[model samples]
Target: MSNNTSNACINDSTNQINIIFVGMYSFISIVGLILNLIALVVFCNNGRTRSHTVVYMTHLAFADLLLILTLPMRIYYHLGFTGLHQWMCNILGLVLKANMYSSIFFLMFICFDRCLAVNFPMSAPVQKWRKKAWLVCIGIWLLTFGASVPIYLSKPSNQTQDKCFDSIPVFAIQPIVVLPTLFVGFGLPLVLMLICSWFLVRAVRRSTVAQTNLVDSSKISKMITTSLLVFLVSFLPYHATLLLLSLNRHNITCPMLDAHRYSLMVACVNTVLDPVAYYFTTDTFKKKVDMGAFRRMLPLNSQSSDLTRRGRVAEDS
Candidate 1:
């Protein structure tokens, strides 16, 4: 892939855009961070979280929290608030990449765990699977760390007032490096998550028929399905654009740069969008939110479910 000299040449316009991105990230990161943290606290305080799903929710919160922790550096980096230094770039890139990949892997884990629980509910209690599940989560983090370390180890670039530059050799952007990241970070994980969610939905539907006390599991299924779909819908476009850009770098023109920037912005949106996905997918989070604790922690107001129910009933009638 070839880099466009004009695009690579960062100008006042580029700086303005980056600043705007930082602003957006700041708002998103703070909101998502606070919500996930509240979820974590509620999980700890409530005794209702002994289920396997709640355990997964805890780890999911940790992954998201780790990602949120790194957002300030990213915001600063894009804002040009930080000194453009090699170590800073390396460290920031490493932490961000690690957390991102870890989150992706954990999404896969949650989907798979759900699938397993639904498919094998009669064999053994899910709590017995908890220890092994944690081990698997740790293993996923280590594996993702291994795959993502190169992003940090790669040479750093400096963004000056006059221009944006990478000290790393241009050849470093070769398909070899780019392809692996696209696969590990986007492609493979996307495929695995989709497969797992599919199986999970099917398993849940099948198992629900055998369980007598369970209400219709459609709500839970919808939550998982929507979460995974959001991940796909939000991230897939960006990855597709990146892959196209990677493959046709030599011919990319100035007009395309605008689209590329937008795509990058979309990819960055994941930093904010993920918490919404987490809140929807995890039951413990919904319960806490329903109990008004979530609104109490934030400055938001909670409307009563009774009013909502009345509205729903009127609509249905």
Candidate 2:
């Protein structure tokens, strides 16, 4: 095929992929949002306030919820929103980018927290360090908000085929956006999680030797492993694409366009896969869903005192 013909074909193929992903992304975003919202509600109502796992889950839900909130703008972009109330378009793009990237930080923190808990059970302040956790959560949001501020303020407005709006300042774009996110979000998290999982496995292995040895907590380990896997798989491609696309300057070539579209779809998939992982990993969430319970059956102050005591006992032992 001639270069012109090949380019046209590539353009058409890219559009087709975008169309398919746009609709799928919207649907998945809606489902993820609902599931995360439900998990949030259950966490709040069930008086799981004392559980560190619950706290992490709550924050994760918050991150996923934000991602869902931004989906409409994405749908608009792909569906072609022109003259979309200037402010609306800007806000939409801003929110979409912010939430999209912020989710990575949340995932990173969760991995770090889990790793700490698993590897240093005694030192890892699970729930007693709730204040610290809150601070960390606040820090994560603030840092991400600052990092993604460009997406909101700098996104090119009046974007059309002929017109252009640079989503972020070219100079402001740095490895901070890609390298740190990749390292912290996927690289560091994956390594730490693997180490944590290894230690957890060893812990479980030792448990088998003692008569009173607790059966392996396969549930939590499985959940963490699954979460790490999904997070790494779904996000690596998107970030990698961004890194490569960053090299794309004034180029509308087939390969660049193909990667750009594919990355977008992968990011969308994360929105869907995230909630599924959350639901599977959290037993409290699962129980709530299975029991069709929205409200707390016990008192608001109720907690698994025995479990808390046992956790403390186990650590002491």
Candidate 3:
């Protein structure tokens, strides 16, 4: 009787947690959809696609938009609406995971582009590759889809009683798939982002006056800092929890499970935060945003070159 009661209590607790999660997902889905849609429209207007950074950001917003679109089914599933066929689940799951990784890689690509602009400003390949950014975005989408195949194949055909968006048991799938995903999907990209950020900082410090003027140094600094923060605060915890859950073979304690749930939600919150990053980082996007309001909220150092020259002349006189 005691054992049965304990099990009942645990189930009730899990259900309540799922309810809260569903509510949060609904909110994020609505807000993320709107923000990303606006971002796409802004990026598409006025020939903004010509810039490499805008091209990457436009794709990133599209990926996030798709990810948000999957949330309604998830919300419904969590609210006890069942009877979904296995294939439907698999397709939804595949798209969700694929786009999640797609957003990660595209953000990494943006970082790499910025790093190149800062460190190799005069390089021919850097100048030449801007036109080919669309091709690179296409390759990223293909690679993301390819990586999702293992997930689709391994997912169970019947999960009527299973929790929505739950992780598959680690032993059920080939280690090859799981291990590579942990490394490539999260670890490798994270390392590359850190390296790019380090190089970008160094380049900014060594930049000449002309280079600094060409790209707003303050904006670059803000972009790199925000990107690193997003990776560290949002993505890192979620991946760590996933790694631990997988390593423990689905026998993790309740606290760890809760941590995993919360961390995953935090990671999803990145979809909304990304627009803020783009506004600060992308010159074209920044231009579209109301400068008066933006400056009032986050004022830039406004001492102009002419003002500095006048001050110097005053001192000399």
Candidate 4:
């Protein structure tokens, strides 16, 4: 009787969590798809606007779109449709990881772009970097695609076909691969973003023109804060759980697996958060995609006016 009761409780919790996951992914994928489509339309229509920030953000949006495509399959699986083909799993897994890594790379470059423009407004190399950013984004795509190849080659030995995206085989998740991905892919980018944000703040404070350009300065601060919050909130727990996966690669537990899945949901939440970055960081996004338009899509509208108002207040001060 006791064992039966325990099993029933575990199952009840699982069912509730599954419902949440399904609903969460459904909402995120839908809104993310629409927002990213709008972003691309705006960027494409932004003729003659060759801003470095736009270049990085454009790629970031593209990456997000690709990543969002995989969410439906996840929702399908969560709905008890687990008999998916291995090839389909391989392809979705590859695309999902490739874009996930690419999104983070573009995010890192976006931070660096802002920091460079503010801190080195005169260097010839920096001036030339606008053109170079395109090449860098292309390279980011190639690198992430290459890095994620293992997912295509290695199949999940433990779980059935329905268990596609939830876990990976321990052998496939080699320590070398996992460690580097955790440190270099996530850790290094996080560190660089922090350092760049610090430099950006200092440069803004010391700017000879800052007294007159308070609005731009506030915009910079808001952009940095929004980007960092997105990164830390979405990516941090996922990577931390990823490391834990490595430590207990051999003796995995059900709770640990659940934690890993939940962390990944958090990361996917980045797709929605990316638009917030767009609103705060890019002038084109701010002016072209009005707060009212963005709000009609979601509650991000509530934040838009507050940010704009605060910037105006700073300017008035």
Candidate 5:
């Protein structure tokens, strides 16, 4: 809780490490900004007809955007151009937790939704159900923001110090913050997602679903890939590193701290990936999002069945 990242910790870490951090954020911020904005446009293009998946995916993009929009503040603070205030540290802590947990929860829901869509293709998609789902999404926003507040209790004042220089503050380093969130934020959601993936996998195996036109075979494949792959890539490494970070809090060496920091950079990759991966039914996805070269790397919508598409997710009404 006391800024475990001592002055020696920071100085011992090479300048090359700092350069990599800045370089990664510089690229991610510029490209992630443009992609996420376009994603918002695609998700909200037709509010009247936006489906349940759209609702969940909208929140996902929105959460990442909150983090994306604020990256410059983080970058400047890290680069030592600005000594971040205690108040700003608290605020950024909230924003960081809010983005990570909310996105985690939303991804779990999206997986469940996709499962239901594929499983219950003909089951009536309750209009009221979609309406009520928005309440759950709102609750997730409130829950993540609210829950992150407690960890700040353990942080040192650092009121007169370079608050920003303590890069891995209570949020990442404290057992109180890292442990519970690792369980609830990443572990629980990941377990739930794995279950959802299991069901969806069985659904995908049923080649009969494709022949009847009961479901869009390609769509099912896209949802499964996006939900599982993104959830893992965005969260798994960071949380794993965070776990190590917490266990080794007292003995946090330079390399371990650097590894944890790198995990964060990897987490930011989701922003660039989300537009293509999250929006399965987006109308203007291909038209407006000029990601053809990038799209090849991401292989969304290409149905390679038998390994292709899940569940009675009521269609997006």
Candidate 6:
């Protein structure tokens, strides 16, 4: 009777937490979807999308957008709408995991790209490769997709009413997969980002031009700082929770499980915050968005003349 009562209590607690998670995911889904969609339109329409930095950011926004697109099903599943087929659940879960990792890697790519640009401005090959950023982006997508396939295939079988994000039975291949994933997917990228940010900061401090242009220096610093903070704030907690869950799989604690769910929800906030990075770091995007807003507020003929006058004044200053 005591054992049964304990189990019942645990179930009730889990259900309550699941309800909270549903609310969190619903809020993140709505806000992240809207923000990423706007970011996609802005990045796609802007002429600056041709640049390597913008190219990486464009792909990053697309990845986040795709991830959030899967959130409605997740929210519904959490809210006890569990009539979904197991295959559909697996596919949706796989997409969420796949894009989450892809977003991390793409952000890493952006950091590395910026580091290269700042640290080696005159290298001919580095400059030439900027034009081939599309190739790099394609390669990253292919690599991320291939890495995700094993996890997708390893999806645990589930009952009809099972929560979509519930822990699955460990598969024989899961150890082989999870170990590398924990290290490679989370650890390595984090280390690389830190290294890149460190180098960027050091390079900026050393650059004479950075000293002359306080505004540019501030912008660059803000970009790197925000990127690092997002990675730390969003990805680190989730991955730390994942690591703990993986280690404690045999004797799972309810609090640890709740932590994992909450951390994952926190990571979703990255999608909403990424547009802020674009606004701070990308000059062309900032200029274009500003011009767009200005055009909307002014008459068509006055727009061109005003923009011309402002450009001349800026040059004079």
| 1-317 per-residue lDDT for model 6 (tens digits) | 12333344345543343677688778778877876676666566644225577778889988888888888887776665545677786777777778888888888888888777776666799878766878988987887888887777865564333444554324412457668877888788889989988887887688653454422566667778888888889888887777776676666556766777678788887887787765435655556566662354446524321322121100111
Write the residue-wise lDDT of candidate 4 on 1-317 in tens digits: 12333333334443233787899999989999988888876676553544677788888999999999999988887766656876777788788778888999998988888777776666788769755889999899989998788656765454445446654435435687888888878999999999999987887788654444433786777877888999999899988878887787766666666787788888898988998665435555666576343444455433333333333312111
Deviation (Å) of 232 in candidate 3:
2.0
Cα-based lDDT for every prediction: 0.58, 0.57, 0.67, 0.73, 0.67, 0.68
The C-alpha RMSD of each candidate to the native structure, in angstroms, is 6.7, 5.4, 8.0, 6.9, 6.9, 5.1
Candidate 4 has its poorest 10 consecutive residues by lDDT at 308-317
How good is model 1 by TM-score? 0.75
For candidate 3, write residues 145-245 as lDDT tens digits: 98787767866555434344553333323456657877888888889999998887776677573254455556567777898887777688877777776
Residue 94 CA displacement from its true place in model 2, Å? 2.9
* Model 6 collision count: 0
Enumerate clash totals for all models, in the order shown. Answer: 2, 1, 0, 1, 10, 0
Q: Candidate 5 — number of clashing residue pairs?
A: 10
By lDDT, rank the candidates, best first. Answer: 4, 6, 3, 5, 1, 2
Could you estimate the TM-score for every candidate?
Answer: 0.75, 0.74, 0.81, 0.84, 0.81, 0.83
* Span of ten consecutive residues with least summed lDDT in model 5: 303-312
Q: Model 2, residue 122: displacement in angstroms?
A: 3.4
Model 3 clashes, total count: 0
252-290 per-residue lDDT for model 2 (tens digits): 355655665566567767766876775555545565666
What does candidate 5's lDDT look like per residue over 1-317, in tens digits?
33445555655542323566677788778888887776777556535446777788788888988877767766775665544576776677678767878888887887777666655555565444545668879999989988877666656674444535346654555676677778888889889888877776777677455445455556666666676788788888988888887887777776776777778778887777776676534433443354332343345733221211122232242
For this target, which candidate reaches the highest lDDT against the unseen true structure? 4
Candidate 5 at residue 315, lDDT?
Answer: 28
What's the distance in Å from true for residue 106, model 2?
A: 2.2
